[model samples]
Target: MRASTPAYTMSRPMSESVAAIVNDDIISTYDLAQRMRLLIATTGIQPTQENLPEFQQQALLSLIDEHLELQELKRVEKDQKFPIILNDQEVRDEITDMASNNKMTADQLLASLKSQGIAEDTLFQQIRASRSWEHWISGRYGSRLRIGEDQIQATKARLVAAASKPQYDVSEVFIDAGRAGGMDAANKGAAQLVAQLQQGAPFAAVARQFSSSSTAAAGGDAGWISPGEMPPQVDTALEQLRPGQLSQPIPVKDGVYIIYLRDKRAGAGQTLVSLKQAAIALPADAPAADVEAARTKLIAVRSQIKDCATLEATVRNTPGVIAGDLGEAETSDLLPEFAEAAKTLQPGQLSQPIRTKVGLHVLAVCGKRAAGAAQIDHDQIENRLKGQQLSMISRRALRDLHSTATIEQR
Candidate 1:
């Protein structure tokens, strides 16, 4: 006979006994409590017993969804005979990068997390889940993507255009009203900071001591950020100042900020590429043979296309095929294979089939423009596309899995 499944337990103090079960995975009351504590601490939101139940339910559901997705990922991989593994060193490196971005040492970050009641092991589990999901995606869908030369060339040209614009390097000392106690206190703090700067105190030294932002540890340095990256008040203030000049207290929503113009430069436009693609979707219950057949057909199409216009026309009448225009995307935005292909193509060239999450794609290089010619990076385009695709696949996968799952909510 098969051995019974293991039990799940938690160590935190909790008023409830159990929360919910995601398939065989149990979400405990203590697990919810720890998550609530971390949420409250990081966001500076007050937690109450009244709100705790709802928070616990929501958090439990989110964790359940994650577990379910992971199960589906594993199932898909097993059927495809794809290896899905998470490297511990990669997880550690990602954690290290997060800490560095926050201007905190790893030890300091761990201490902060502990103070917020977040367990290190919980974080590790989350990281493992994330890495596993990525590996599963690559294993299942990696061969479907083909980025082409025209796509890369278009991206490079866009980058060159973007480089022609103006940009500023700014530093700031932020005193949030909530942290300062009130608007009046925040204003006073900003004024005091201004006085220190005027009195010849080192800006970085004073920022290290008085700034309330995470950037405080980095001497309030924001580091070569574009105007669009900053709040309007800060951006406006910086715009009014010359290089090496400081601004008076600039009031903004939630805070008062003292701004310093570290340096300014003519924006260096980087290379960008744009591609038009046709994608075919596969149903959740589709057989492995059927999926492979579709992949082969798309690959065949890629080999025959000579340019973007021809590729676009070729997919015009195909059912379930989607045409996507990734306009002026950065090198970092396109996949590795796509970016490499983009570097060699002229305008109107067609790329080989590129595989992504949705299905097989045949790319067409629509146009190539120099960077800095325009703001090409649309806010969150890549993220939005990825999220939409993942959501679609996840919904289909979950539906299939749930049909056979024995789920209980408590």
Candidate 2:
């Protein structure tokens, strides 16, 4: 029973201007402006002339949703003769936590907002609506929700099987096209978000405030996703990104996405090893005497290379010897000599000096993880399933309210 986009008209307005009407209530121009400012301030999204219109649209949409949620909750409470109390203390507590995260006191935060010309009530009302809606959702639906043992087992099995694939630690921000009014708006919004992220905006904060994905509640953390698990476009994007980089806006059927890669690793079940190499570079056809000298030089320093940390310094101190970091890699992926050496040594152990076509090399095993070692526990899987269910329920309920409500935008 979802309705189409609520009819809207474009126009300029002063502080006292009416921006939208919802049921029997109104959202004023001042409210929309302050909310937009708050979004930028809390989320660290830079405000620019090019993106101001997108910001306004996002802010207005958020306000409309909040109005719908609050109004529905009030109606349910009154009709069912139940109490749905969200007091100032609760809002204050949230503010305190938020301020503490930003390394500011509540008073200081309010003062800072005041300096920005945002009224304190604007922040409070937003928090109140969010908390109230969460309470109502949990209370109304918590008991009815269930996760079967089979479901948990299936999820665990799937995760364990997928552990053999490469995984990326990722966070995302999704802009739903339907909510944004069309594909163009959604893409523009996603591009705007990407611009802000590239300019040093905090990704987690921005995701919490703006992403429409279910993971938005967890600041868009998707946590160790493997290839083939995500959409083809997303998989392609992740493949092109290195650790600590963001993807450009990727348009999909439902919306657009911006992803941040925190880290990536080889297949979890592979024999992962961290190594450092000390080598004396030599020609393939070097004289036997020259090769012997290189071997002697490496041998002399081999005992001195007690650990990975000191390997470089030891090499630097010894003339004609060079140091290299093999970094972390799967043993099978390493060169044959390096792989064989890695397989035989434990962490902190050094291999005997070995000769190769390029040089005489000494390898130190900094660390190792045995094959088939990845794990995701039962509790974590259960919680993820429950969260997904709750998110779906919340979305469906809200969509119903939107369809049944009276709304007009100006």
TM-score of each: 0.41, 0.71
Candidate 1's displacement at residue 332, Å, is 32
What C-alpha lDDT values do all the predictions have?
0.62, 0.82
lDDT: which candidate is best?
2
> Candidate 1 at 125: error in angstroms?
1.8
Instruction: Find the candidate with the highest TM-score and give its number.
Output: 2
The clash count for each model shown is 37, 0
Collision pairs in model 2: none
Error of 2 at 364 (Å): 37
User: Which window of 10 residues has the lowest lDDT sum in candidate 2?
Assistant: 1-10
Worst 10 residues of 1 by lDDT: 1-10
Alpha-carbon runs more than 4 Å astray in model 2: 1-15, 270-374
Candidate 2 accuracy as lDDT: 0.82
Model 1 CA deviation exceeding 4 Å by range: 1-16, 42-54, 73-88, 146-391, 402-404
